[model samples]
Target: MQSNRGTPLTPSQAASPHAAAVADSSVTRSASQQALILAGVCIAVLVLPLNFGGAAVSAPTIGTALRGSPVAINWILNAFMLSFGSSLMVAGALADLLGRKRVFAVGVALFAATSLGISAAPSLVWVDFLRALQGIAAALVLAGSSAALAQEFDGHGRARAFSMLGTTFGVGLALGPLLAGFLTQTFGWRSFFLADAAIGLTGFALGVPKLRESYDPHANGLDWPGAISFTAALTLFTFGLLQGPESGWSSPLIVALFVGAAVMAIAFVWIEGRVTRPMLDLSLFRYPRFVGVQVLPLATAFCYVTLLLVLPTRFIGIEGHTAIGAGLMMVSLSAPMLFVPLTAAHLTRWMSAGVISAIGLVIAAIGMLWFSGIGFDASATVLAIPLFVIGVGAGLPWGLMDGLSVSVVPKERAGMATGIFSTTRVAGEGMTLAVASAILAVLTRLRLADALPGSPDASAHAVTEAAQRVATGDLAHAAAFLPALGQPVLVHAYDGAFRVLLHMLVAITLASAIMVLGFLGRTPSPTSRDPASPTLS
Candidate 1:
């Protein structure tokens, strides 16, 4: 009305104040939208790792339902990890080249659909296949989601955001077994998949409209050769590991897989050097700090996976705990992770990143050693101290390592960086499971042979195979199959196998501590602009 009526109002005269108001409203709206997107991303991240720990507890149940052997049950976990780890770098490249939001949405949708497929699967084969597909979807989601977050945040904002992510990760891991036990016992193993599907669908719906798009304009072309070779190398290596103990370490098939893995690994290295736009920047390894940080995740995953497999098995098989009770016991191992990350910064006042990380590894190793000292009849109460210590050690370096690993790289390559980091973590998990399982199986068989000397070779083998079920905490089902007289022998053999596992874990964790002390360089502060001297804080 004023513009129309009076004084032939100048262009700025009528619009300046209104423009400022509109701009303020837009800024506020954008911030709100960012908040929504962050919430969605955190939700997705929490759910993904939850599946890892939850499936650890539920694998025996799934194996029973599908009439799967222990080897086949291993594949249930491996199939997902193999596909997920293999495809992460490729998915990251795709996110950089295409759009993060688009890829993330697609991933969420695929995950939702695949969850339904897994829930309805008729056979173990179908379940494995579906799990593989879900892994692919997970790769996409993880790459896109993290990249998107990196793009939107910077400085203190980024630190806080990633810290929150770390906390959420711990929460998911901590609660996963409890949720899995409750759901599986009340409804069925299928209920977890159904819940996963529902969560995925919710994320998908929220992502499509709420999440903004991001892409790296300078990203290079996709590296198909690198992708193929890397995938082949990892798959072959994992296959060899999985088959080594089951088929005999000297088996032709296992030997061939190992050879194939070596060849594929060489090819991958060759391809990465030649590619114009390499999926992985080989130069990143030039920095000892980066290399050390990358390996830290692997070490963390190794310890975590070991406990994830061992604790539940011990609780259920030896202590005669229900699934829920076993899960409750795991709380001592996982709960500390929730609170320790927030206080990790306090350690910076007295120690450098490398020293802190090395100390953490040493502490974790001590925990493993302590836990291993307990006898077969030890109670959960006796186990709590070491479990809590291990959890604290893991939590201390969780967010710090992740933040430091990616800090050396420019923001533009966050997708690739995140992918590589994630690959190492999951691959460490898969490799540990494959190798540890092989060791456990071989040793368990040998222990069974020793325990039941007069039994027929076939009889011992049969019972040993059944003992694998008992060792993994499926005591109820395994007891149904074995004779009463042999039950004690089976349990004894299983306990001995667990001891072997614990010893191996002690050595592995010690090695990790040694590596951190030897290789991890000092990282610079956030205020530091020096490229040559990087510090983790």
Candidate 2:
């Protein structure tokens, strides 16, 4: 039953050792029952983060109570993302080595405990530390859940399972803000962390009985060096990108950090090639379809994050919508996510993954183009259409690409493949935001220069400061200039930003389309089993 390439199962067979252990027992439930249980666990794990954004308004109050600086407040949020992103590969590798169910249970316990700590922390430093712990817990849950899903189902069942996972993720992203708002408005910001604790505990209780051990006993030992090097490289690179805008891009510290990151990355590649128990096998890119599938998520995530950053400011700052109203308007951006998984599953019955991905990219490109036309006077409803379209575009690719990537590989390597795919998606999103913001900054300065001529010192300084403020979305400072010059300068800067974002979307979409068409030729028949399956591999 071992697959040749490294996927655990063919998407049609069970890869869990527990499945075999229970195969002869008359006490086993039907496949549908097991799937439902697994899906419920996935949803429970995902709901932990749903209230994050809503807590944004309450962060200041929390910060004051904890005696933390504004910088500490930022860390409280960023710590989660950084830890979550950096620990993914490590979590996945551990799961493949130690068994998924055991590691997953451990993660759930840690997550619940850390959430409680975060909720009760008396100082900013404690809160930030707990948040990083919570993020590590999240990485464990996410990595284990994904690999387990791939192990438990194959073929159309696999498609449905992947769709369910995507749906769970989408729900989390959409509800996070709404839940945060309600909890913060009523019980205070601490309720958000409390909620995460509750959810994590619930998942642990359910998963203990239903989740089964899934791991290849033949898997290699942990590659600690590779893991450390990879984590350090990604962390340094992300830190440099995030700080470059604020610290001055040409600063010695920033330049040195990037250089260090580059060196670490090169060393990581070299180490992986020689290590017997590599954390990530660079050889996976040899499969053209696998490579193509990876690119779709990278491109999609890049555009998705950019849109999320750009749109709300356009609504509230330019159109004068209240914060709550702007948030409501942005709901359209996530609405399509609700239906995309089911839609993608149905479409996969007839369409190849490549075709589906290409179509999605085209839809996303069109949406980006539509968004570019938005101006200072645009109505909320007018913006919703493109936002919804963008959501639809983003929704389909996540599940489709994820399913395809795992499906193409052999079962034994499923964990590594999943980890790599996830890492690329996060890296793409971070890089996209940084790159797009940099471009917008440059364009805004040029426009500012053109608008404020005849006074070189004033014009140069004003343009530089304005560009920085806009990149950071400092509306107060941006509004200060509106009184001095007519609002035309601000409007032009916004327009330039939007235009550049649109072109980026188009270029990325086109690249994604080409990759899909040229590399992902067709969906292979769902017959081959993944060699990574515990029993088979």
Candidate 3:
């Protein structure tokens, strides 16, 4: 038999079922090379938001272009996250049960098609719908690619593969805003989605001829019930969280959504326990190291998303910087990500995964502490130091954590484990954004009351808007407030926001550090599997 790359099966391999099976099912060298290439192609899908985040200074223009209402504009950005977070586990399991190569190819095709649809969308509703579809494609690619790489490589080779994947993912995420800012500034928001479609199509054309499928012949059935329940729980929970502030948190609808989400989540656990083929094996938590690996990523994700949300608001709104300036400031957040994966791989040679993770969390906490001290008057250069420190801490843990997660699980279960890990990380990222926004809102209102002498309600509204504008540094609007309340009120509000953001970071990071160090014992060698490993199967 010949592989997709036209490599002939060797005679000795043909003589043995296992060898033939491995050769037939395993990735070709060309396929492995293409895996990294495909990963880059898939990353283009994320560029839309990165561009939008910085360019949303022109949200009114974007809204007009898409013919969307204000609420629709928000959905255009959030729909992707909602679908991406909800579908990740199902995509991973499907890829494992079916074939990684096949699912990835399908995802690429779907993503390309949806990107084009978004480009041509006549209304915001259609654009949002297409974006949701694009998220499903992204989920499939992300979940399948990681699992495929895990199956294709072992030992040092696996570490390098993961490092490369993590590095590419980080780079894509960082570059998205930069590219988006430039493109939106020059071309328009439509260019972002168009470029993504073009890139996805190009990658698919180059990869389809060479990519290989990786799936265990002995893999269990897909956990439809688990996938459905998990998706429902996440969707309802995220919706409630996002809507809580706008719709009163005390609203009956909000209350029902939260309760429904909680009930579904409990039911998901019960269903997973009884199912022979669980989407996420509950038993993975049994091993302290495995639990630590999972928790560490969640922590890192929380910090990363929180920073992404808060920093731009602080830099552009409060400091009177331009959109470009705000995007550039994130260089501190993103530049370190490029080098961290390689650095993490190197560190893994000297230290255990647990120690590396713990150290990273501690450093991140310190960075958060330093960031808390930043006032309205702080210089851009001064801010970069702590931002870069947090980036470094964020970068160091992922490669090691991913390597450790797969190392402990049997090869056959790699897809399921990888899927679950991705789901948690994505959920953490989304949840953190919502949580951080709520915190900032509350603090802004409180600070306004303390800073102003007018009617508390009037002052709170004015201060909240001023604080938001200051956080984004929309100097034109923020400057208007300086005359009414003067710089002192703006300064006080900004200080209050920074303090609250810092506290949140410190609390989350400290809690994560404690969880890792206390729960995750010394890392065992890759070959050792705790007989007491906590897996649902």
Candidate 4:
């Protein structure tokens, strides 16, 4: 009776039911608030991946409608990715210093606004501008929302919450192509943007009010120098690659870009080493398992994400498949993303994650080789086998990598581990895609030159333009530029150029697999979890 005030009482110890009833009400209220917070963040997360997968499928349609150069069309995708990838670490740092909820709400609002703006864009330039802005907003939304979600749960609850978040991202990627294809095929490309805009607005309304504000007490101020240097470095590097095929690789402009890129990269490394709370925690790279964790995403970028754009272009641009038909075929490539992760999670019962990842990559390499032999005459069912195999192979490591990201490092370093992994995963995709695009364009240009009619009518200028057009998935317009060779010859040239790129991807992917296996061989599995530490499974 002297100290019952702060204690939860048994039924017999309670003087009246009123006190117990009040305590029960407080518990109920706390549970209700948690549900609201989870709902808001998950809804916002869905639209970001949706754009990645959706926009890839819509490329051919967007190209035809927007009437831009192959370079210009390529910019549409790279512009978004570059801004998003380069901005993520900075955005995360800012979220920690300011408030997670504040950044998250603003991000959602800006994302919604940009989506709406892209929907009504009159030209590719407008779309490109808005898409880059959308990417920055996307980084803010992702960084803040995930951190906020982590703050609300602990241990098993935290793992489960993040698992749900991962699955939501999976669902978006799984459904993006099909949904975008349907909308584009039925109405127009603009409809896809409009649909995403509606989804973004709904997320904003649901999440903004329920989200609680929080900040990292230990976070130092933002690293402005590191952010600027890193962004500039990547921008210069990507520009050099993209413009190399058009402007002679030895051109003064191209050389300057490359040199600038190298200088900025060195500056970024210097800045990170000196910063109190660095944008990149360079110390983590010293660990072999942590290094391997980084390799996994770069491998996937080459094998899986790069194909999302390439396959859609081949199906709709060159082979004349309808958007709906291409979308249906893409199900073979992307649908495994939805379920294979679950299957791979169970495989850990028999094998190490590294073994499983390496084996998966080997399988993808084989599938890519098989795809190199496929031609336009092959039936859809026959075509899908290689693509499906690639999908399953990629899915195995995809499931395990998220957990490995945090678990590979010590508990105190988990946040930094996650930031590095997320940045690598995203930035890897952008840089890889840009490089792949350059190779495809450059190779296609050479092949087209060889296939040219060797008459005065077929000039080198014409060959370059046609090849650029073809690289961007515009076989019809590309064919128009080189009428002497006929469309058949142009298509064949494109096919030959493409097979070489596929072989290159196969080699790089297998090499990365070996690196991951060697590096992750000795790292131990996490045995115990702290209830207060944030993590994902």
Taking all chains together, each candidate's TM-score versus the true structure is: 0.87, 0.79, 0.79, 0.91
Judging by TM-score against the true structure, name the best candidate.
4
As for TM-score, the candidate ahead, 1 or 4, is 4
Error of 4 at 195 (Å): 0.8
Give lDDT tens digits, candidate 2, residues 1-537: 242223343221211211111111234557776766675566556654463343433444465466454235545555665676667667766666676666677778888899788788888899888887877887777666655655555566665665565566667666665565456556776887798878877766765567656665555566788877877887677667656544667889889989998999999999989977666678888877678778876677665655654454455454555545655665677656666745765676687767777778778888877877777577778878887888888766654665666777775555456557666765555456556655666676566666664546754555566655554444456546534554566766767766876787788887777777777658652223221111000
Residue 453 displacement in candidate 4 (angstroms):
3.1
lDDT of 3 by residue, 364-453 (tens): 888888888876677778988998888888766654555566565565444345445556666666666656655665566467556666
Candidate 1 lDDT, 1-537, residue by residue in tens: 011111111111111111110011122336677677677777765567677777766776787688766666777788888888787777766665677777777888888888899889888888888888988888787766755655555455655665566566778778888887778777988888888888777766655576656655455467788888988998898888766655667779999999999999899888878866676667667767667777777777666666875566567655666668777778888787777655665665666666677777778878877887887677778888888888888666664665555564554333345446666776667777777777777777777656555867667546656655665555655566556436676677777887778777777777887887676646642122111110111
User: Which of 1 and 3 is the better model by TM-score?
Assistant: 1
Native-to-model Cα distance after best TM-score fit, residue 177 in candidate 2, in Å: 3.4
lDDT of 2 at 29: 55
When sorted by lDDT, best at the front, the candidate numbers are 4, 1, 2, 3
For candidate 2, which ten residues in a row score worst on lDDT?
A: 528-537
Assess the local accuracy of residue 469 in candidate 3 as a C-alpha lDDT between 0 and 100: 47
lDDT of each: 0.67, 0.62, 0.60, 0.77
Model 3: CA > 4 A from native: 1-77, 120-127, 147-163, 213-221, 408-415, 449-495, 525-537
